[model samples]
Target: MDAFANRPLSPDLPERHSVHDMLVGAGLRPTRQRLALGELLFRGADRHVTAERLFDEAVAAHLSVSLATVYNTLHQFTDAGLLREIAVDGARVYFDTNVKDHHHFLVEDDGELHDIPGSNVTVANLPTPPKGLRIDRVDVVVRLRREEG
Candidate 1:
């Protein structure tokens, strides 16, 4: 089913006043599930969210969005610079609301993400890219495991 079909291009927005307006600013067409998910996502301080975790939250809010929809929307949002994607591990990925340059800490036990300021690390000794390409950005993830009981 088309999750965005017939959904409002404008809904009750979060603090920014209009989630639809925000989506439009981000170049996304405001669909129902997208608006709902946007409200859930952009309503507070910047943070990270995984598709599975967002799916759980959507379900709890009685939204009818499927996990696939969440994944697709997240990718779309990332492509539009509404969020940033980080591959924490081979099997784990996260979307960060703060799109600026920065690093992260991955909590192993709970799979949570914590921001590490951009100034905390420096990259050096990078090989040159091909003639047609230039470096866009770099990502670093620090993993943490809890102390055993």
Candidate 2:
């Protein structure tokens, strides 16, 4: 077996430290698992991810991580403002890499997610928040089904 095959798919030093700094800046401890997971999640362009999907990637890349750990770390990252959690339904949830304010298009048939510019959506008559609470943000998931002949 080749050494590279078993190596963790982390980035080079500068990038690796950049990811490390990102975690620290977000108030999260930069542990080995967190760094490894961050490396995969931030591999390329910003996108959405689920704990299950991340776990699979970790396993594929031979990273020593568990599904439960993925879930915990994802939640921590979310709490630290490093990721945005998009709940698709009562049972499924996804973590979005793009943290900016925006809407989403959920392709119902395929369970795909696409970003909708914030300017494209307008919400009306939102019920007032509780006396001491304020509206942080609103999430709109427009469900689209495939066209039928």
Candidate 3:
């Protein structure tokens, strides 16, 4: 159990103070744009989102944000360890709110992403890295689709 373990995964957004504190803790200056975007990203439950999807969400929420700004902000958050970047395909990328090490399951039909517990997958028999390079982490995305009947 940890400090964040108590926060419930709900539909409601977290208090602004907490989001502000999170940005500060991440060594980020909580600017107006960041605060608004952070509120949407950090609102309730660990989930995955693409930059375009997030931009649409911001627009739907009546927040005056640009798509480019959304992409830049997401990259910043990932760099600050506030989120994780998952590249499923060269064309599709997802920013995960849960920064913990874990795998994912992608539903092909619905294009939904679900988290797989870190312990659920086993990775073994890895080739040694090059002389100076080291393996930081391995991300596995299991894609699934319903069988044709």
Candidate 4:
């Protein structure tokens, strides 16, 4: 099934909270670049975006933000649990603002990301940790390819 086919195409979603609020909620200082970048990342509908894609979008929108700023903001967001980093491939990293426990399906042909609800997957018993090390998170990325007809 085409994951995006069933998705809604509406444009009137509610605006997200102010950047200052987001920064305060995440326990980070609301710097100028952080404010702008936070608005860009979280103001709209939730999305799975790469840093390169975000840079391009910022430039196209005339937002004069620097690449370093984007990287730094992304790092901060990830550290604060406001964003979830997904390693679809070894090199390319995608950032998702939805921090809920869920999985993703990546279409290899076009780099499309589809969110998989957590309720659909079941987890059984697992092995215990060896020692002081603890389990931080579990992320699942299923890469999809078109099957020959």
Candidate 5:
């Protein structure tokens, strides 16, 4: 893990309070686990993380949080629009903090994610929705594999 990944919590900006504020802003009640895990998710730079990776980081940080709590918190964050869930593969889900309209490039071997700026792609035409249903949004994910030399 990198240094920032393992850095200690800032006393002035504790995870508990940060998570509480985030939840409150998103109209969610700040539960104990939610607060703890949300700090882990939202603090520092934006990332593409999995539940397992989050669990490991929490444990390393001595948060005493459980794996289930990580998943639950992630789901809540997604619901609250604080985190964006990307379906990169059948068995794995990646969370991103860049919630704006954009796309992703998934590195298959390492599971790394890269943001694809929206301006780089153009969608000039699209099929209209039928009936009363409306299009909420569109997501494009480009899966990439390392080319052998």
Candidate 6:
């Protein structure tokens, strides 16, 4: 199913208002660019996206935002606890709309991500943290590929 189906692109925007309210709740000013970008990011089921992909979507939707703006805004949202930043590898980063604690399945062939419920994974013993340090969070990205026929 299309996750971005039926998104509003007109003047009479209920979703825009909600996105505005969300920005305010997150202690961020609801600028025109933010509202537009937030609407695209938050208007559907939780999913993952890269900055380049989001910028492409914005361009496809005629949103006048630079790629740098998208990157900065994504980092801002992550810092504000509205999104989660997942670094799959050194070169690839995905911004997840679901901020809850959970793992992910990375499809190697297509670069798709699927959420793995936190309850399903178990972390056993771990090496003790060095002095003056503690474990913050555990992020597991299980890579997957189709079996050969």
How far is each candidate from the true structure, as Cα RMSD in Å? Answer: 6.6, 7.9, 2.5, 6.4, 6.3, 5.8
Which candidate comes out best when scored by TM-score?
Answer: 3
TM value for model 6: 0.87
Output the lDDT of residue 34, model 5.
Answer: 77
lDDT of each: 0.82, 0.83, 0.86, 0.75, 0.77, 0.83
Off by over 4 Å in 6: 1-14
TM-score, cand. 4: 0.82
- State the lDDT at 26 in candidate 2: 74
Enumerate residue pairs that collide in model 6: none
lDDT per residue as tens, model 3, 50-100: 999999999999999999999999999988888889998899999999877
The candidate scoring highest on lDDT is: 3
lDDT of 4 by residue, 6-39 (tens): 2233132223345566566667888877777776
Q: Write the per-residue lDDT of candidate 1 for residues 1-149, one digit (tens) a residue.
A: 22223223323336444667767876688999889998888765677999999999999999999999999999998888878999977898899977877999888899999999999989999899999999989998988999989
Model 1 misplacement above 4 A: 1-16
Per-prediction TM-score, please? 0.86, 0.87, 0.90, 0.82, 0.82, 0.87
Cα error, candidate 3, residue 53 (Å)? 0.8
User: With candidate 5 superimposed using the best TM-score fit, by how many Å does residue 149's alpha carbon deviate from the native?
Assistant: 2.5
What would the TM-score be for candidate 2 when compared with the true structure? 0.87
Clashes of each: 0, 0, 0, 0, 0, 0
Q: Find the 10 residues in a row with the least total lDDT in model 3.
A: 1-10
Candidate 2 lDDT, 87-119, residue by residue in tens: 989977989877777999998897888999889
- Span of 10 residues, lowest total lDDT, candidate 1: 1-10
Residue 99 lDDT (model 6): 75
Candidate 5 lDDT by residue in tens digits, 85-132: 988768989888667778888888998999998777777677899999
How does residue 83 of candidate 1 score in lDDT? 84
